[model samples]
Target: MTPPVPPARLLVVDDDKGILPVIERVARALGFDVQFRDNGREAIDGLEELDPDVALVDLQMPGLNGLDVLRAMRDADPDCRVILMTGNPTIDTAVQAVQGGALDYLEKPFDFDRLRRLLAGVRDGIERREALLQADASVAQRVEFHGMIGRSPEMQQVFDAITRYAPHVRTVLVTGETGTGKELVAKALHAVGRRHARRFLTVNCSAVVETLFESELFGHVRGAFTGASDTKVGVFEHADGGTLFLDEVGELPLTLQPKLLRAVENGEVQRVGSLDTRKVDVSVIAATNRDLKADAGAGRFRSDLYYRLSIIEIHLPPLRDRREDIPYLTAAFVREFAARVGRPITGVTTAAELLLQRAPWPGNVRELRNVVERACILSDGRMLTDRDLASAMAISGQAAASAPPMLPFDEADDADPNLLSTVQRDQIQRVLLDTGGNKAKAARVLGVSRRSLYRWIERLHLEA
Candidate 1:
């Protein structure tokens, strides 16, 4: 049996006591759970906790008018659809309301028919958006591939290459930008290879010290060095009969490149201070974000070693290049984080999803994962909204701060510094002062990127 959907939440903010009952009656009749706020200030303060699906705000109020409330909603709960009500409507106020992100404008003496249609439309839109999220979540589960979620043509090619070469390749080089899932590709290669039952080991070439590189790659006998109290089997010997994933392989020291080349070519490794070499069968998978071909040509890396590893190569595309996969990746991350955090979050709001899709993911999949995880942790409702995502991006230092404000300012008001700009500048100044002029800290407090904060400082002509 199909379950009944929960009633949508509606918040009514109007100073007039006489109209509250009318809106409540009509809204409840249409299956809405209604809440009332007598003034815009109270409505603005309660938006985060109320998490309303729709808000009806009166344009004229004693303090904090409808436009103010609309701005608050945009910051606190961007998924809420807002309707502005005015008793004495003017062309100017109507334009301002629309520019402030109001979904619709309502005139006085309450046209019950129009109100009913507006409420019904909002409910339908919410239902459709929720249904789409569910569908995308379902597809995300189906398209996930070995800890990676992607459906774009570039990703499909990567998967195909993995499948085709995993079973046969002994030496494979994986290349891509940082955080592009090169380690996952290496693991997939090991998983699908013939040595799946054997041990799979990893070593970050960039993390190892210069002097310890040889000992880390090959075994070292006891008393081989000053502090060699006990014999140690290196990753090569430990992963014998299996696969060795050398991450950041481009950082490998030039002096040790010849030894690595010999190991990869002949499956032979000589321990430190040992005269004899031991033969071991091991599959080597090297991954690097750097251009090894260019590095070899420039004499930074060995051409022979580069050629040996590139015999079979797999490249993973960056997240931005494969943006068609963003939705699926977001859905998967939402599910994973929700389960891990014990949250009821089913998916992100449509606005939030659009923000994720439009973002320039400089850190690739890893950055997206961090953003989603942060949003899931901070989310208070079932759906993640654009406000939540923006805050997450800002904290992660990846937000597009140069983007225009959500509320469009009039051209005439631009020269005079409108209310929104004043509010923004004052807020930034206060945060900067509180943080001792630390731009990074101020950016986090303001929920903006450092680059954005710098732009704001320059545009506002602030000292710091």
Candidate 2:
């Protein structure tokens, strides 16, 4: 469900009890959690306590003028939105108020309509700032599997497939986009298999230089090449009677695919400088982000080798496809990062959670983990807020600090349904973006059911 926005904090300062009641009523109706003070002195004292989003101050007050309080607030928190009111409105006062960073100025008896509009504007400004912060909050609840967490049906299927095939499969192909936890799946397959106690080594095909591909996988004797100073067992030989994880398998040079195919098929590997072939019993687990079948068809990858490696294929879903699992993933990340950084962060604010849920997560779980870890490192409070998140994420070029402008809300009494839907769609999009495109979270924030959200998405053609 979409979480509710935090109430805007309001500090009202006025000596007139008559005016205070009206302002309090207005603030309450606008969904503000308010704090009141009769004099400027009291208001200044309350500033530290309330830490308000918008402050309503009478220009002329006992003990301290409204301007004094404004300056104090500016000194304390320049972000606090302020509004100045006075019975004797002057051009000088108005000019001074704006210079003082007051959002709006009012005189004498307030125009109830103007007052409502002004307060509403202030309320919106607060919500927008909160949304910005919420989107950035990084701490989450912890749920995981060998340093991973996923509960979506797609992820569960991947988990089930791992368990089902690990004990029996000879060569398993794990394929997915980068950051989808392919290596973890590879580890899980090894850990759950009968060879759990045996050595499990990983070789990143992309990381190795092209010339060293054969030597790295099959070993090379001393003086085999300019850099081969000593005889060393290669990955295949080192993982004998265990498992060999070939990551980024698509990057394996086509020239070396034949040699790798021969090793996997016959359990035989030959040293680079020797003629003798050594027999090794090793399970090969190949992972790739690329579509090897398509590559093979395109003649970039060997079709015969692709067929051998993909005898048992397990595809991992991208983070976007499994939006249902974000919360679990977030919680797990929060816990993991908190422990690593020795921070007492327990969870993320609702705004923060919604923002995290809506992200596209182009980098997948690994990106999410790194984001949370960065947030943990930067956090000061026990709970993570949007500000902490925004600060961390902004470094990556995401506009996490500024909230998107809200759609216009004031419309005719008999507004067009289509027009209303457009507004609704805008709101949904904002919420979805804040939640990182998590439909369930978006629905909750929009106060609609998941089924309703889906219908809206279909009708509106929402990117969600």
Candidate 3:
């Protein structure tokens, strides 16, 4: 089953009669189960009873002001995201609300698109905070490899595949790009399988020199080579009666393919510089970033070996491919690095998350980790500001720190942009610029049908 959104319980508090239904409609549309309150007193009572993931309050409320409501809500639970809403907002008020521990402040006549963006950032912040708590192994293991983070159906399918293959003592092949955590999947399979108690030895095929591959996989007798002073067992012997982890298996040389295939077929090994053939029982788990079949067809790898290793195969989606997992993973990484580095960096600020979601992370999770670590080191206190993230991302020409967006709102017409519309505008503009006015090229660049791009162009109002 897919994981539900972490923040289902939400309370919307505003004094104006018009505010309640709009808040309710927006919150409900965003899949939040919302409770509405007319003023601060009712909001406090509702918050105490409901204990929501977030509380949206108006700064000007009858009796106990919005600040009072925020103070009360936070005093009850410091974690709840309290966003202050106001019309005719001022710089002084924004500073006060932020300093007073409000998650963020939104202007009146909600920018639904911006509001949605804020909620996403709030969810990310909550994840990062929780991840920090989880980083304490003593606390609990909150992040797991299979279906632990994302709500997408693809991830659920991957989870199901892992569950199905975790039991048997067969060799499994895991294929994925770097930073997708193929090793994590291997470990999970071993941990969840019947061989949980046995050793899980890992060997990086690419790290081994061509001459040392055999010696590393099979035991080397004394005087096997210049460096072999004494008898040393190889990974196969060491992992006997257990599991052997072969990372970057696609890097294994063609000359050793026959030997590896032999070992797998016979369940035994032959020591180097010795006429000894030893019988050893071991299960193999292999991981690779290359297309093994293509490599085999190109004579880079052995087809027979590929089939043997791939009795069960699992492909992990890249971080960008599984965009739903970024917030979860980014949150986890931030918490972990902050605690390790002894920084109170509690969460990524709203602008930081916007930059993250908008960028194309070519380097995947590893790059994200580095960014989080850099942010952790640069951050001063409990939150990671947009500035902390800016230098690390290397997006060469980022926008100015703070400026009103170019898109003007029609407040008089009640035309608030939604996420889909915002995305369409962004896509159209991005593709148009990339294609240099060639609509066909723009459609291909966007991975959308030409007709779809044309429709988007018409909808978003384009110059090209």
Two-way TM-score contest, 1 vs 3, winner: 1
lDDT of 3 by residue, 152-197 (tens): 3455567767778888656899998887778888888887888779
lDDT of 2 by residue, 1-464 (tens): 23343467888888887787787788899988888888887777656456577888889987899999888877656667788999998899899999988888988698888888988998787666555443432221212355556656687678778879999998999999989999999999999899999999999999999998899999999999898899978999999999999999999998999999999999989999989999999999999999999999999999999999999999998987776666566666777788888888776665666566666777888877777788888889876777777665665444442332332221111122222222355577788899776554565566654434554666556787
TM-score rank, highest first? 1, 2, 3
TM values, all candidates: 0.57, 0.56, 0.55
Tens digits of per-residue lDDT, candidate 1, 213-318, equal 8999997999999888888888899999999999999999999999999999999999998888999899999999999999999999999999999999999888
Residue pairs whose backbone atoms clash in candidate 3? 346-382
RMSD of 2: 18.5
Runs in model 1 lying further than 4 Å from the true structure: 1-142, 401-464
Displacement of residue 369 (Cα, Å) in model 2 is 0.8
